[model samples]
Target: MAGVNDQRDDRALRADCGSCFGLCCVALPFSASADFAIDKDAGKPCSNLQTDFRCGIHTRLRQSGFPGCTVYDCFGAGQKVSQVTFGGTDWRQAPETASQMFAVFPVVRRLHELLRYLTEALTLHPARALHGELRRLLEETERLTGLGPDALEKLDVATHRQDVNVLLLRTSELVRAEASGTMKDGRKKDRKKDRRGADLVGARLRGADLRGADLRGAYLIAADLTGADLRLADLIGADLRDANLAGADLTGSIFLTQPQLNAAKGDLSTRVPPGLTRPAHWS
Candidate 1:
């Protein structure tokens, strides 16, 4: 029962990446591989990164064998922590600042990630009544971004994430309030789970049913969707780095990530993600 608002909110969150700093390239490490043909140490700028922090190979990342770059998302925390909080000073200028910035980056990332989810969840018609609550949380998160570096670094990110998850649980309850009634008589039998275009990074969706799902363009980085049922799902354009699909059923799933398939238990019945090769076991 996804609605137009949910779709619109999802698109808005995805397109809001311009406001972030290019922290991913600098904060993360990458080794030479089909996805990245060079070694990049954490805190060291990629060779393709320009003085202004823009990716020189952005246009040709995929064409140049850097498919990993195409699927990376920082949840808008990179720029905020880099420019607004720390005043755009990189680790090169002040190496001591790296630890603090790095620590705060992940925390702010969690906040922004929650923001993305809440914003999307608010779009559902069933959750419209809680729009005010959502708006309050969103505004609070926005205000946090404006805090000084010291204050930002001192934040209790785990507490904030827990508080936000409570609100999200309320949101989920509101959205699925009537689903139980629909489930009894097989009212939901015809309704397929459409995870298409979702951003499920580091999410824990274990043991979920996702038959005939359309997961195209989904961002599932580090997601623990272990033991989930994904039969006949579409995964084209999906990003699945570090995702856990162990013991999951991908029978007839389409466009699954290469690493997930490589690490998971699948068979000839499993459908592979696009732009990736299936493991020998799957064949």
Candidate 2:
């Protein structure tokens, strides 16, 4: 039942806005574009953020012309920084700590993203050979997340992510190798569909059969993926920002992360894996 336990833990590690102090809304900046309605600067509280630290347009972010907000997920970093790192202190209550708090938020956010992938990698039975290494990295990453604000602000997240990427690549290869066997003639046809590091920005891929495809690090920005069959596909590090996934099926996709999903557009019919949730803005 390790997989079941892992799924439960995944839920806990997800973005819990209820427990957060609007860190993403305040710490991050966005420019006025098709995705966002207004330009905002880092360290400034979003105009829509309420005194209670909740988005005023939470229920109608898209309608309010702030579709970007609907797709952002802090991956539980907001609450961890606000409650654990800052000792539950609000920025409004202690203005002096605001600068350091904003600086540390993104650092821990990256660490939490790594933890999410490592946790999922551990659940793949085909990658059992690498489970020990995954666990060790997971523990080390988790320890980094528990560091104080000063330590977190000074963390080298890019270096840490580079280290974790090596094991993640191995895990993806192991799991996808088993999936490749289920392809036609067992000839690895999907391997030919590799789109690694390809710039697919706004590509018209509607209804494309991308099952079992290797899409690691693909730039899918604003691509139309409606009705695409993405089952068993490895989407690790894929930039799905603004990608249309209204009717796409991702039920068995491997290495897909919540942040990737959170950045995409999907509807009620879009089938996600077990641990991920459907985006609320989807009609």
Worst 10 residues of 1 by lDDT: 3-12
- Candidate 1: list runs displaced more than 4 Å: 1-21, 32-34, 88-99, 177-283
Clash pairs of candidate 2? none
Q: What tens digits encode model 1's per-residue C-alpha lDDT throughout 45-130?
A: 78887766678887777678787676555656776787677887776678888777776777677676767666655555666777
**lDDT (0-100) at residue 193 of candidate 2?**
72
Query: What Cα-based lDDT does every candidate model obtain?
Result: 0.64, 0.85
Best by lDDT: 2
lDDT of 2 by residue, 1-283 (tens): 1132443356647778877888999999999997789999999988999999998988888788887776666778988998899999988899999999999999998898888889888888878899999999999999999999888888888999999999988887777665554556555545577788899999999998787678999999999999999887789889999899989999778878766887898898899998777866567
Candidate 1 structure, TM-score to reference: 0.58
RMSD of each: 9.2, 2.6
